[model samples]
Target chain A: MSTTTLQRPATPSAVHLTFGRVVASEWRKLFSLRSTWWTLGLAVLLQVGMAAILGAAARAVAASGQGTLPVDGVQAASAGLQFSQLAIVALAVLTITAEYSSGQIRVTLAAVPRRTPVLLAKALVLTGVVLVTAVVSSALSVGALALVAGEHISFALPGAESARILAGAPLYLVGIAVLSLGVGALMRHTAGAIAALMGFLLVIENVFAAIPWKPLQIISPWLPGTAGSRLMSTDADIAAAQAVPHHVGAVLGAWQGYGVLVAWAVLALVAAVLVLRSRDA
Target chain B: MIEAHGLSKVYGTTRAVDDISFTVRPGIVTGFLGPNGAGKSTTMRMIMGLDRPTSGTVTVNGKPYVEHRAPLTQVGALLEAKAVHPGRTARQHLRVVGATHGLGARRVDEVLEMTGLGPVADKRVKGFSLGMGQRLGIAVALLGDPSTLILDEPVNGLDPEGVIWVRDLVRYLAGQGRTVFLSSHLMAEMAQTADHVIVIGRGRILADAPMATLLAGPGQEASRARAPRATELAAVLRSQGLTVTQTGADTLEIVAGTPAVAEAALAAGIAVHELAPVRASLEDAYLALTADEVEYHSGVGAPANPEVAR
Candidate 1:
């Protein structure tokens, strides 16, 4: 009798796709989809185009000597960040929401049974992609604004103020991404999540701020969008003038502002984890 | 080997999969049989750890599926008709999953070739036919070359050739000492491919036995009869320990173990007209097992029912 041996190729262990490998895989998934690219492209276009146009307008106003160059060049350059934040939020929500829409989340969960790891991997990938884009976009917007405005925009590069705002913009976008991801996980529906996120950022917080109450104003700075917008502004004078009594030092200091953003992010992430763990895929 | 111990799943107030338990072994294709709402898909999902069981547990290779270090390498499954993202190309989709386990692009291409999907490897899944999508699903299942496979309704939309191909592929896999568990509502398909069957209905196990044993089981009625005048064969066979029913004026149906008894009766005094064994088909076995448990019964009488004909 003759015995035959079968040859099998080596199979990698599942843990080989550690949290890091899962993050990389998620990054590939996020970027390969047409929706991700389209949204990211729109974010860049809106950021850079709005910055250039605003820079031109700001130069005209400054040249006429009617208005002071509002803040620093980096702050003005990143003017698009305000509007572009919506695009990043949409991208982040869609990162997980698309799976629910297409019924692919089940497959994803099956591949990685530890639910928290899958959610964390998605957040990590989203943060990485959005942060890099936000940083590059902010820098280009500032540089373009300086060149087109044709004014020696005395923006401190690598200086404390410049570094703070520069670092804060990406951090702001990251916070928005996490906030939107939490909303997405809670809602589990793309339209519902996006609508709820937009409403909370654009309407509800502002309405609460409008109430004739000091406590509302004090707490308003900690809301996701409000905290993010506060972190993006570079004019210390304007920031100070608008700051509430107790909010003066806490809201004006760079690290303090970053801390507010992180607080909102952590709260949203915790909520997202709870919803994801409790809900059915 | 894979085992399910009192597995149950509930969605709201409805129990999708009741407490069902069965074992799937190696070196054979075990057909997971059920009717259309019989919880076959839900059970398969629970086994794969896609859906958490409400009560019991399912283990693969003597461990919970989630506890396995390499789940895909331990058990590969194609849970649905098509689970790929529509935007991704076949190769890209496979590569994304492959990368998770540190498997390179080469393995993706290899599985693509094995599934005969290399020709359309670069095409977006949105444009692929149902058959192509099924093939893609199978490709992913084979990506890890696992020791066990669980494919749910894998032959749903295949052509005859594709059907034959899948049957061969599953049988071949089982022949190689791998355990193959497949679910299908089509009894003919199971009959052609499976060596053993685990029949389910109303989220409960109906039967779990070897194919041959199921065929020869006692609950099913088999017929044989013979007489000089075929019309009188029914009466004579009924005189013996057989229940002879009439098919036509000249033909009779006798529920018995063998035709030799009918032959003996004919040789004694009566002339033999015909003596043949009436074997129960796979469909008969399945319907007999699940007849009482079928949800939404049509309320229509069987065509063979004498009262219904009248």
Candidate 2:
């Protein structure tokens, strides 16, 4: 039906837009940029490298038999998250913000006029890519910790505690990545969105959690950063949060913390969708 | 075909696109001509659904652009040049946009070659000159093989060769029963390519007519009189109640009949070197039609519009 009769069917052939194809388009866009791989690689390296380093320190302290090791082997394996999450934050922000910086959003919106699907597709691709990175790096981190400080920290993968720790690491990373994606869409500027997310994760959440007040402590667990951190914590870590004389608050479990993080992501995503549809591209 | 009914856009308090309605028919090239900040881009954006109209609606083919099952197939648009992520290679950019419509690599390569961009298909778009970027934009507009096309300033950054290529391409597409709507600041270029023209100014439609009728204007016959003593001929013609404007040292644009100018020159003993009737070109017609509508005027004759903006 698209045949032009004389010049190569200028209108081409039968083809139409689909949700599946938009997902594919998002995939291609994410992989085409060199920054995506470089930043993601940094995230993996930070996670694994921190796990091994923290595991060795835990082993040394135990060997001397002097003081209580603050973090267990499970916590050590995921400790790299402290630094690796920054990489995830940067990557997620760039995923959506780069389009606006380069004036490509207009072209993208033109292709997919419904607007909401573009954000959904981008979130899906980001989740898929970051999940793979988080899983592989987190696993390697667990292996490295077990290899170096296995006996000292009683590290092994077969137990329920270790399994939850391993699984939670990737989910936590994916959550942070999706959360950053929504913020980036709302703020449309790379540095500005990164600053806002960094402030929320590093400054605001930590400040409220540190204040020695009951109500603030109670509400701290609801903060996305504090809630998300619960996913990677060991029993010792949870106990420490409670032991703080000012820590009279709800003790969130791993999945529960992850659910809170997911809720934050959903809130940001819904706001992005509404703003994107109503505002001019 | 493209239809707009009372489509308007208000950015903050400024009416970027006022209430304007027009039809762009199939099988013809319709030129959207306007001065800077005259709402051409805003109108085109409203039609493409890039910017929502505040008051009314615009539709491509038969329904609103967003309602179409395949928007790219319905109307491919190049609203601005270089609307691409510079970090990605040219081929990658096309592949990503085309994938939304389920268009494959074969078609991607076809468009790359068609736009004369095959050699640089794999190169990042960061280094492309303005002309190359324009070609890439046109390449994107053609990716879906859409039946209706909207290109705003399609030849803004093209070289002479590229300009001619776009003209011939638009004409050929329209000849094949496609709807081609384009906006350009180049008056001579529109005069050459567009069969019908829509003149817009200050967010309003000032003139919408065929090429010939617009150029012919409102039956105000103008004659170009060139004589050795043009000033003397002007004085004689002015006394006869004729509006005359000195276009050159020897040539005068007289808003009168050719016979009157000749008779005045003959009576004044001024040698008439040349005298003939003149039809306004699109540029002249446009300037005359938009004399009062220009947003910003250099000399002190036109009023300034406080609301128009980039």
Candidate 3:
């Protein structure tokens, strides 16, 4: 049993590799990197900070009683989520791509050779961390505004409507993280996967809108970014316009938006699973 | 135990691993010997279930690695050293890997100490030297206390002490009735360490035999004669059931020792200008075995005479 004498115990215990163990392993892997902390920290700051800043600005406008554009409390609470989505995406992409890029995927697969468990474990861990952070950030943003500037903010919707926004925002962010993880699993290169995910979300929808063809412009609403934004924004028109300035009233209803985002994530995850199952690690 | 039947892999236009069937049994140190790009790593990956065989199958214990409930306990593999995130420390890397199979922190710490990585366990792997990285890889492989260990180039970048340590460690493990299947391109090391060897060349198994058989087998010998009659001498040697390949205008390399070839030539009345036995080191035996299968043959001499790839 001396450490210097490397002897594998003659009889190994009847230990099975459970899914819980894989989840624990993945959770450890996720937090062990500096990028995870930096990305998570930056995401929380941006989410809470931007929400407070936007809420304060709108409150100042309402105090003057002249030029205040009505700001919904939920929208004000999640105003920073748009920018912080990049951080969540980064964390998700790194979840899968870092393994591939560093050759750790081989080690991971060798440890859990069933493959699907690894992907599932990663998705679960990512969802858990991102969902918790997003929920906390949204709650803090709303709480901070209520403490400082809640009196001036006009109702986007009161009671349950605002609560829906708070809940839906975290779900939407988790969906994006899952989708990003799928993309990372497929692309396997950190830069390439991140570029593909971000480019599709940020640039492709705009490109579609800029096309002079009306039929092509209609394709933008079904995109992951447009759909996710709908979940965060109470006004579908405003969310559509925000994602692509000229695109107006093209966003799905809140439930439809959730469904589309879920569909996108599921479709991506299924494809990623197939690729992982059939191809070499 | 590890078993493969008609295991092969094809990458685009190249056959990375041709139909190779071999079994690596427990209680022995089996050296997977090959030149670079000889499909040794590919075979190892296939065994680990990291790569799917295009046409065949490989199994560890009694099932494919993926089918095993406890793959880490069944087989420990070091496919590459430093296959870790650069930002994570050595201990963190081991712990993360260990967590998959419910391996405890105590096991991780033990491996860290055993591999001489305890001192730098908390240092980021990006700063690790090649030797340290190799040790970390070994520790990860050992973390599960696997019954079968597959290590690819475990001695690479190690100092003399590390190399000896690995040698003794593997031999000791084999003595304990554990399977140690490790790959290396170094014939000298393999000869010194392996109880058995499976030599491969150009994705094909060139020789699968005991270490003694591989070392004592027929090797290339150069027998020289007058330039005018060298071709005749080669033909005469060939007629005697010896493989004679033309090396130079006046020199013929036969796959036999000097005495047999020289006696035949002398009996045939072909006066040999010179007859010398080329000392066949294990390295020479390897070069001779894989003379024609080398993908990137060096410019020097070019093996004199190449064997026909089977």
Q: Write the per-residue lDDT of candidate 3 for residues B92-139, one digit (tens) a residue.
A: 999999887778879988999888888899999999988898999999
lDDT of 1 by residue, A178-218 (tens): 87887787778899988888888878888866775777767
Best by lDDT: 2
Residue A162 lDDT, candidate 3, scale 0-100: 73
Restricting to chain A, the TM-score for each candidate equals: 0.85, 0.88, 0.86
Off by over 4 Å in 2: A1-13, A59-70, A147-153, A156-158, A239-247, B229-232, B241-250, B268-270, B301-310
- In model 3, the Cα lDDT at residue A68 comes to 63
Residue pairs with backbone overlap in model 3: none
TM-score of every model versus the real structure:
0.87, 0.92, 0.85
The per-candidate count of clashes, in order, stands at: 2, 0, 0
Task: Give the worst 10-residue stretch by lDDT in candidate 3 chain B.
Answer: B301-310
**Candidate 3 chain A worst ten-residue window by lDDT:** A1-10
TM-score, chain B, model 3, is 0.80
Q: Write the per-residue lDDT of candidate 1 for residues B1-310, one digit (tens) a residue.
A: 8999999999898788889888999999999987877899989888877778999999999998876655668777887756777898988888777666676688888999988899999988889888888888888888878899999989878888889999999999999999999998778889889999998888889899998888777564565554547655555566666676777656666667555455646555666656677788777777778878777576466522111111
Ranking the candidates on lDDT from highest down gives: 2, 3, 1
Provide DockQ values for all models, in the order shown.
Answer: 0.38, 0.72, 0.60
Candidate with more favorable, higher DockQ: 1 or 3: 3
